[model samples]
Structure formats: C-alpha cells, structure tokens
Target: MSHLEREIAEQPQVLRTLLRAQAAPVGAIAAAIKRFQPAFVQIAARGTSDNAARYAQYLMGIVLRMPVGLAAPSVHTLYGAQPNLARALVIGISQSGKSVDVLQVISDARAQGALTLSITNDANSPLAQAAEYHIPLHAGEERAVAATKTYTAELAAVALLVTALADDDAMRAALNAVPDALDATLTLCDPIAGWAQRYRYMPQLACIGRGYNYCTAFEINLKVTELCYITGVGFSEADFLHGPIAQISPGFPVLVVAPSGKTLPTLLTFLEKLKARQAEALVIASDEAAFVHAQQQMRIPAATPEWLTPITAVMPGQVFAMQLAAAKGYDLDNPLGLTKVTLTL
Candidate 1:
C-alpha cells in the first residue's frame, strides 16, 4: 500500500484518538471562547484545511447562530490592511501549521483584538504559538502529498469544538459515534475498489452536495484532482441547478454526498433530475432509499443530527479517490509537483 492509502486507512483510529485525548482541551478552548463572546467568526486556511474550515463555517452558523466568514489572507499579507475584528473569533487551520499567510492572518487578527485560535497537528509549530488558543489535531505525521488523516482529524476537531461551545449533549454524542461510523465506511472499500475500475478512464467529474456536506463535496473534488489528476469541480446542489446542470450530458459522471438530513429531500430531487438526463450519479448516502435514482451508491452508517454526517460521509469518497488513483496508475504518495506541506503567502 502507498503512504496515502495507509494514511487514508488510519482515519478511523485517528478520529477516535483525537476525541479521546483532546476533549478536555477542546472544552477549555470553548470556555475561553465563551468568555470572549465574539460576535462573529472568521476562519483562515488553505487547501484541504480550508475545506475543513468550510465545514466549521456551516457548523458555527447553524449551531451557534453566528455569522461566519472565511478570511482572505491576501488582505492582510498583500494589501497590509487590518480590518476591525474586535468582536471576532479568528481561527487558523493548517496541518503543518507553517503557512506564512495563515499565520500572518492570525497575528493580525490578534493584534486587532480578535480572540484567535489555531487547529494544527504540530502543537509547537509557529501558527499554534501565534494563536491565543490551540487545538491539536493529534493525527500524527502525514507523509502523503495528498492529506487523508489530517483532514478527517480536522473535521473531528471542529466537531468537538462546536459541540463544546454549544454544550449540547446530543451533538457530543453524535460526534462520539463518528469513529465507529468511519470504521463501517472502511468496510465499503472492496466494493468501492470494484466500482473504481469503471471510472479509470474518467477525465473529469462533478461532486455535489448542500448545507454541511457541501464541504465534503469540495474535499472529495480536491482529493480526486490532486491524487488522480482529474478535473473535479464541486458545487452546491442549488448552485448546480442555477445553470451548471447544462454541462451534463448522457453518461457523464457526477458524485453526490447525500447523507440523511434536512438537505436529503432536495438532493433526492436533484438525483431524479440527473437520472432524467441519463447522468451517472454515484451517491454517498446513509439512506438506502436515496439511492433509487442513482447509477451507483455507497451507504454509510447513519449518523444522527445530520450536521455531523460530513465527518463520516466523506470517508467513502476518500476511499474511492484513492482506489481510482491506483486504478489509473498514478502515484498516490507523490503527485507530480505537490509537496506534503504547501506554503502560500
């Protein structure tokens, strides 16, 4: 197995470890956040970490009922402008925690009176040191160019952080179920590998979802593009209907993440439309009935409260991307020009 595959398989355990070890620290951070009582939340990240931040954005907005915005690091790193963030909670997420621009944003946000936090695997890294509070990913070292364990670890960390802030027992319990759900998701590997052979020659595809899982669509799209060298575009189901649906032709490949939730009905309707167009849809869903209209499906064990589904629903897509890359004879551990840690400024 390649390093990427090994790291991919390590996620279930990594998530379990993160929750087991970091719950207290996460709670402490939550206490700090409550003390600060920021009026808004801003997240700064890049690449896979940025996609995880998108998940955080949705969680904070829906659960905390606070406005969440993704920070434009260039505004601080390039324009050298410091917008007022006196009542903001600024979070910087990175696996290596060494990105120059991400750290700079955290520094500036702190200088502007924002309560700054960082989520990173390296507790001693510069980004962690820069933030007032740090949440360690506890994912260990990830040597693969395409991140696997760290991304899921980020999801788990975000879930813990949100649950801590909300102090909701149900959400906390839902998160506790994620590791087991992911273990079940890994059992689909044999079938997903069989399914991947059919798409070995696929040059491009679309990944679609809505609400919280929209970030999963983007993360899956990134995995495919980075590991398999395919042109994979991610879109919210609503946005896809707003004219991007015109690009679909008969037998075109489309992947949908439709775990059971409030958004499931709309996703099923979208699947029906895809069926009418004869578009091949491979849906990752917890509800088997939701697969009736799709060309193929991978069923994950149901995770409650729906919002927490992204943590587990994303596993099948990760497996599919890894298997498809291998089927296409690409190096999973090392993409053409990509490195394990990407530094952007």
Candidate 2:
C-alpha cells in the first residue's frame, strides 16, 4: 500500500486521538474566546488546510452566529496593509504549523489586538509559537504529499473548537460518532475503486455542493487535481447555476456531495437540472432520493447530522482520488513537485 492509502486509513484513529487529547486545551481556549467575545472571526490557511478553514467558516457562522471571513494573506504579505482586527478572533491552520504566510497573518492579527489561535500537528513549530493559543492536531507525522490524515484531523479540530465555543453539549456528543462513521466510510473503497476505473482517463470534472459541504467540494477538487492530475474545479451549487453550468454538456462528469440536510431540496432541484443537461453525475449522498438521478451513487452512513457531515462526507472523495491516481499509473505518495511542508511568504 502507498503511504497515501495508509494515511487515508489512519484518519479514524487520528480523529479519535484529536478528540481525546485536545478536549481540555480546546475548552480552555474556548473560555478565553468567550471572554474576549470577538465580533467576528478570520481564518488564514493554504491548500488543504485552507479547505478545512472553509469548513470552519460555515461551522463558526452557523453555530456561533458570528460573521467569518477567509483572510487574503497577500493583503498582509505583499500590500503591507494592517486592517483593524481589534474585535476579531484570528485562526491560522497548517498541518506542519510552519507556513510562513499563515504565521504572518496570526502575528499581524495579534499585533492588531485580535485573539490569535493556531491548530496544527506540530506544537513547537513557528505557527504554534506565533499564536497566543494553540490546539495540537495530534495527527502524528503525515508524510504523504496528498495529505489524508491531516486534512481530517484539521476538520475534527475545527469541529471541536466550534463546539467548545458554543458550549453545545448536543454537538459535542454528536462528535463521538464521527470516528465510527469514518471507519464505516472505509468500507466504500472497494466499490469506489471499481467505479474510479471508469474515470481513469477523465480529462476534467466538476465537484459541487452547498452550505456545510461546500468546502468538501473544494477539497475533493484539490485531491483530484493534485493526485489524479485531472483538471477538477469545485463550485457552490448557486455559483454553478449562475454561469458555470454553460460549461457542462452531454457526458461531462460532475461529482456532487449532497448529504441529507437543509441543502437537500435545492440540491435535488440542481440534480434534476443536471439530468436535463445530460451531465453524468457521480453522487456521494446519504439520501435514497439522490440515487434516482445520479449515474453512479456512493452512499455514506445515513442520517449524519448536517453540521457534522463535512467530517464524514469527504472520505469517499479522498478514496476516489487515491484510486483514480493509481488507475492512471501516477505516484500516490509523491506527486511530481510537491513536499510535505510548503512554506510561502
């Protein structure tokens, strides 16, 4: 097995470790955040970590009822503009905790009076040192270039952080089931591997989702591009409808992550429209209704809470990307020009 596949299988245990070990630290950080009572939240990251931040954006917005913004690091790194962050909670997420741009943003936020926090695997890395508070991912060492365990570990940490801030026991309790759900997701690999062979020569594809799963779309696209070398793009369903749907034609591959949630009705409508366009859809859904429209369907565990779906829903996409890369005769663990730790200014 390639390192990527092994790392992919490690996710459930990584999540378990994160939940068990980080609870006390995250709770302490949550108490501090509540005392600070930031008016808004800002997150800075890149690549896979950025996708995790996108998940956190939706999570913090929905649960805390606070506005969340994804920081444009270039604004600080290049433009040298220091915006007022006096009443903001700034979070920097990096698997290695060594991204220069992420660390810079956290440092600047702190200088501007924001409460800074870091979520990372390396507790002693520069990013951890830069932030006022740190939540270690406890994901251990991840060597795969495509990043499997760290991505989910970051998601778990974000979920825990949000739950801590809200002090929502129900949400906290819901997280306990996540590891098992992830374990069950691994069972789809055999079927997904078979399905992925059809897309081995696929030129390009689209990944679409909405609300909480929107970030899943982006993460899936990233994996497909990085590992499978396919020109994959991710879109929010609303954005796809507005203009990009023109790019779709007969037999074009479109992957949709439509877990049962508040977003289901609109997603069903969108699926119907895709059917009308003759666009081939490979759907990841827990809803039975989604199977009728999709050319291929991968069912995740049923009734996964919408807020918690991001943690469970992303696994199939990861599996598909890995399998597709192998089918294409590409290296899974080492992509041509990538490394485990990427530092950018």
Candidate 3:
C-alpha cells in the first residue's frame, strides 16, 4: 500500500492511541482553562489544520457556550498589529509544530497575558514550547504529504479538550468509543473506491454540510483539490442557497455530509433543490432515508453521537480523495509543489 493509503487506514488505531495516551493531559488542560476563565477564544491555524479549527469553533460554541473566532495570522505577521487578548483563551492547531505564523500567534497571545494552548503531533516542536499548555496528538510521524491520520487525531484532540471542559461523563464515554466507530466507517472504502472511479473524470464539484460537519465539507473539498487536482468548493447548506445555487448546471456533482442530526431536515430540503436543478448528489450520512434524493450514498456508523460524527464522517472523504487521486494517476504521497511541513510567515 502507498504511504497515504496506509496512513488513512491507520486512523482508527491513531485515535485509540491518542485518547489512551492524552486523556489525563487533556483533562489537566481543561482544569487550567476553567481556572483561567477566559472571556472568549481565538484559534490560529492554516490549511487542513485550519479546517480542524473550524470544528472547534462550532464545538466550543455549542458545548461551552463560548464565542470562538478564527484568528487571522496576517494581522500579526503582516500588519504587526497586536490586538488585546488579555481576557481570551488563544489556541494554536498544527500538524507539524513548525508553522511560524501559528507560533507567532501563541507567543503574542502569551505576551498579552492570555492563556494559550497548543494541539500538535510534535510535543518537542516550537509551537508546543510556546504554549502554556499542550495536548500531544500521539499520531506519530506522518510520512504522507497529505495528512490523514494527523487530521483525525487533531479533531480527536479538540473533542477531547471540549469533553473534558464540560466534564460530561456521557460525552466522555462517547469519546472513548470513537475508535470502533472509525473502524466501522472504514468499511465503506470499497464503495468509496467505486464512487471515485465513477467520478474519475470530474473536473470540479461542490461539497456542502452544516453545524459540526461544516468542517467536513471544507476538509473533504481540500483533500480532493490538493490530491486529485480538482477545482472543488465547500459551502454551508444555507449559504449555498443564497447566490451560488445558480451556478449548478445539469449533471453537476455535489457531495453532501448529511449525518442524522438537527440539520437533516434542512439538508433534505437542499437535496430536493439539487434534484430540481438536475445536480447529482452523493451523500455521506448515517440516515438511510437521506438517500431518497441522492444519486449516491455512503453510510457512516449510525451510533456515533452527532457532535462526534465529524471524527468518523471524514473517513469516507479521505478514502474517496485517495482513491480518486489514484484513479487519476497522481502520486498519493506527494502532490505537486507541496511538502509535508509548510512554515508560512
């Protein structure tokens, strides 16, 4: 197997390993967060890690009732502006702890008396050293240029932190079961490969989701774009209806991450509209009924909690992107002009 495919297959064990190793440290970080009692949160990340931050934005907001914002690193790196963060909890997320811009954000936030934490695969790396608290991903070394294990490990890290903060026993139990859920989700690989072959010639497409899986939409879109060299776009189900809906032409492909949740009703309605416009939809959902309007359907583990679905939902996307890139005869381990670690200023 290729490095990318092996890394993708390793995610179930990665989550199992991460939760087993980092639970106590994550709890300690949660304890520190509560003691600090920050007014709000700001996260700095880039590329795929940024998509994981989007998961945190919704997770923190829904569970902790804390307002979270994605930090614009250029504000500090380019403009040299220091915004007041004295009452904030600043977080930095990166697969490699080598992003200089992300490191600068943590350093600046610490200088401003903000409580800073970092989630990264490397505990000895610079970004980990800069934060007051750190949660190691325990994902080990990822040799693939496109991240699969590390990205899921990042989401698990974020989910672990939030679950600890809430101190909810039931949610913590749910978190423990995620590895099995991921294993079950991986069973869809053969079907995903078939789907990828069916769309091997696809030049462009749209990915849509809402609530927590909103991050899934963006992450999957990035995977396809980078690995398969497709012009993929991501959108929230609500936002797609506003102006971009007009762009849909006959036989256009749309990938929808529609797990069984509060957003399912609205997504069903959105699927109806896609049908009316002759847009074909491939839905990644737990609800078998959701396939009523879809041209293709990939099922995830049905028992995973809605909040934790992103951890499992992303498997099919990763598999599809990997399969699609292989079908297109592209190198899976290294994409053109891309490296394992990108340190942006």
Model 1 lDDT on a 0 to 1 scale: 0.90
Q: Identify the candidate with maximal lDDT.
A: 3
lDDT of 1 by residue, 1-345 (tens): 788888888998998899999999899999999999998999999999999999999999999998999999999998998878878999999999999999999999899899999999999999999999999988989988888899999988998999999999888888898888788888865588877889999888999999999999999999989988889999999999999999999999999999898899999999999999999999999798789988778888874558878877788888898989888988889999998888888
TM-score of each: 0.98, 0.98, 0.99
Off by more than 4 A, model 1: none
* lDDT of candidate 3 over 99-204, digit per residue (tens): 9999999999999999999999999999999999998998888999999999999999999999999999999999999999998898865687776778889889
State, as a TM-score between 0 and 1, how close model 1 is to the true structure. 0.98
Candidate 3 accuracy as lDDT: 0.93
Task: Report the C-alpha displacement of residue 123, candidate 2, in angstroms.
Answer: 0.4
Ranking by lDDT: 3, 2, 1
Pairs with steric clashes in candidate 1: none
Q: Runs in model 3 with CA error above 4 Å?
A: none
**Ten residues in a row with the worst lDDT in model 3?**
188-197
lDDT of 2 by residue, 199-290 (tens): 88889999999999999999999999999887999999999999999999999999999999899899999999999999999999998998
Clashes within 3 Å, all models in order: 0, 0, 0
